[model samples]
Target: MAETFERLPEAAETGGWLVRDEEAVAAQRGVVWELIKQVGQNLTQGVSLTSVTLPITISEPRSYLEMVADGWCYAPIYLKQAAVEADPVERMKNVITFAIAGLSNTCVVKKPFNPIVGETMEGLFADGTQIFCEQVSHHPPVTNWQVLGPGEMFHFYGSGELCASFRANSVKGHQEGIHCIDFALDGGTIIYGLPEVWVRGVMWGDRIIEYDGLMTFHDPKNKIIAEVKINPEVGGWFSWKKKLPTDYIGGDIFKYTSDPSKDRSSVSKISGSWMGCVLFDDKRYWSIKDDCPKFELIPADDPLPSDSRYREDVSYLKAGDMEPATEWKAKLEDLQRAEAKIRKNYCQEKGINYVPV
Candidate 1:
C-alpha cells in the first residue's frame, strides 16, 4: 500500500512541478505556460539538460532508485510459479502472467530522479527476500538491479541504459535494456525487453509522457515465445489530453516452434493495457489493481547515505513543501557534482579505480 501524503497545491500555486524561473509560486499561466521557453533556453550546441531555468513545482516526487525498484513490486507472483504444472501449455501461461506483472510501473506518469553513478541501494524484505541495485555506469547512464524474491524461489535481475537526445521539438528517451525471470520450478528463464519513453509538449504545449516499444518474453528451455507490444501515447497538438493514456498491448505466443516460415495465427493471444488487466486466450491473464505491494523505505533507525529518504529535497516534497523542496533539489544536484570531483581526485592520488556499480 502507498503511504498517503498531503494534497496537491491549489491551481494558482503550481502546475505539476514545472518551472519558468524558480518562483515559489506557479508561473503566471501555470500549466498553459509553454515549456519550450524553459527547455529551449537550455539548448546550447544541441539539447543540454539545463538551458532554461524553471520555477520549480512540487507535485509528486520520488527518487530514481525507488522508481526503478518499483517495477519489481509484484515479483511475489513468482511464488505461485514455484511448481510448474505437468502440462507445458499451462506452464507457459504462468510465464506470460508473471512477465506482464513486472511492468506494473508503466502506469506511473511522474518522472524519477536520474541516479548518480556508483550509487547503490540495499534492503531486506520481511519475508527474507533480498534486494539490491546500483547505478553501474554514468557515461552510458546505466543501472543494474536484482531481487532474490519470494523466499528465494527465483532470481530477478536486469540492467537499464538511458540514451536521450533532442529532436525537432521533443525529447526522446531510448531505453536499451533487458530483464529476466529465473525460476526454480524447472530452471526456466524468461527475458523481457525494455520500453522507449518520450516527453512531448515540451516545445510549446503542456508536457506529457509517451511510451512506445516492445516487450518480449522468451523461455529458451520450453521454446515458448511471447511478444507484447507497448503502444505510444495517444494524442497530438491541439488535444486536451495531457497525460499518457493507457494503451492496449496484445501479442501472440507460439508453442514449440519459433519458425519464421510458420504462421503465427495459431499461437495463443494475450492483449490489454499495460496498466490494467491483460486478456489472454479470451480470458483475463493478469492485472495490478494497485501501484504495488509495500516496499522497504529508509528506516527511521538506520539509513544509507544514498537512501532516497535521506534526501532533503524529496523529504520536503513528500510533505507538500514546494519552496524548500525546489531549493534543496538544486543544492542536492550541486553537491553530487562536487562530491563526484572529490572522488575522482582521490582515485587519481591513490592510483585506484572507481567502482562503476
Candidate 2:
C-alpha cells in the first residue's frame, strides 16, 4: 500500500519554503523586480530572457539535468504495469499516467541551475531505475537524457531544449523536444510531446506553476493517439466558467483511421489532475495523494569530473552556505561563458558551424 501525506499550505505551494521567510522573500522579490524592470526598459514582451542573471536566492539546490532525471520517479511502477497490459490503449493509459506523474515531480516554484555544457549526471533511483543526462550544448541550451527502468522493463530517452520568455508577472516556458519510450510488450513504443508551462505570479500575485496546451502520445505501430489538454486557463474572464481542478487534464485515446476526414472511435477517456489523481475510463490508475514517490540520487563511488554533484554552487546551496553558493554560481556562469567563447572561436577557425552533438 502507498503512503499518503497532507499537501503543504498555500504559502508553500506559491512561494515554496524559500520564500516563506518574509525578509528573504522581500529581498528576492526586490531582485526579481529589478530584473523585470530592466528587461521592460530594453526588451520586448516575448524576447528570450536567458541572459538575465538571477541570484542564488531563488535557486533550487540541483542542476536542471538532475531535476529532469528525477521527473521519472514513478516510471518504475507505471512502466512495469504497462509492459504487462494486454490492450494497447490500456498500455498507453499507463504510459500517459506516468507522463502526468512526471509533471508533478517537476512543478517547483524555485528555479534549478542551468546545466553547464559537458556537465553530466548519472544516478540510480531507489527502485533500481538508472538515469543519465548530459548537457550536450550551451547555446540554445539542450540536454540529452535517458532512463532505464528496473530489470529492463522500459527505456525512455529524449533531448530537451527548454526556452523561456519573461513577462511583467510571469515566465512562459516552451519545452521543445520529442520523448520516446520503449516497453517490454510487443510494439509498445510511445512517442510524445510536452506541454508549455506558465510560471505565474513572479512579480505580483501568488506564484504558481501551470501546464497549458495539449500533449499528444503517439503509438504509431498501433495507429493510436492520445491527446491530453492540460489546465486550460485561457479566455481571461470566461475561464471562471469551467471551475475545473487546479491541475485538471482531460484526454481521449482513439484509433486513427487512414482517411483524414473519417471519424475515429474513442477507446478510452483520461481524466484527472496531474498534480493529484489520474483516472482512465473511470478507473483510477495513479494518485499523488496516495503514492507520490520521489527519486533520490544514489551516491556514486567514482563520480565523473563533470558530474553535477561536484558543482560547488549546488553543493554549497544544499549545505545552506548562501554567500559561498552565490559566489560559486557567478564563477561557474563566467566560466561557462569563457568556455563557450573559446569553442566559438575554434569552430570559426576550423570553418565549421557549431552544432550540438
Best by lDDT: 2
Worst 10 residues of 2 by lDDT: 1-10
Instruction: Give one clash count per candidate, in the order shown.
Output: 11, 0
lDDT of 2 by residue, 43-108 (tens): 437768655678888788999988886567777778778877888888899889888877766766
For each candidate, the alpha-carbon lDDT, in order, equals 0.57, 0.74
TM of each candidate vs. truth? 0.68, 0.86
Report lDDT (Cα) of residue 329, candidate 2.
90
Relative to the unseen true structure, what is the C-alpha lDDT of residue 69 in candidate 2, on a scale of 0 to 100?
Answer: 63
TM-score of candidate 2 relative to the true fold: 0.86
Q: How high is the lDDT of residue 184 in model 1?
A: 72
Residue 191 displacement (Å), model 2 = 0.9
Q: On residues 1-357, what C-alpha lDDT tens digit does candidate 1 reach at each position? A: 111112112111111222233331234235324554554444422463322334445234666666666655545544345334545456556666655555544434444555666666676555566667777666567878887766556787888876776555556666578887677766877776766655544445544445566667777777777676665233321123444333445566776556523533336766555545556666664654434454443332364686655677778888989889889878866776687788788988999997532
Mark the regions of model 2 whose C-alpha exceeds 4 Å error after superposition: 1-25, 42-44, 232-242, 259-263, 289-292, 355-357
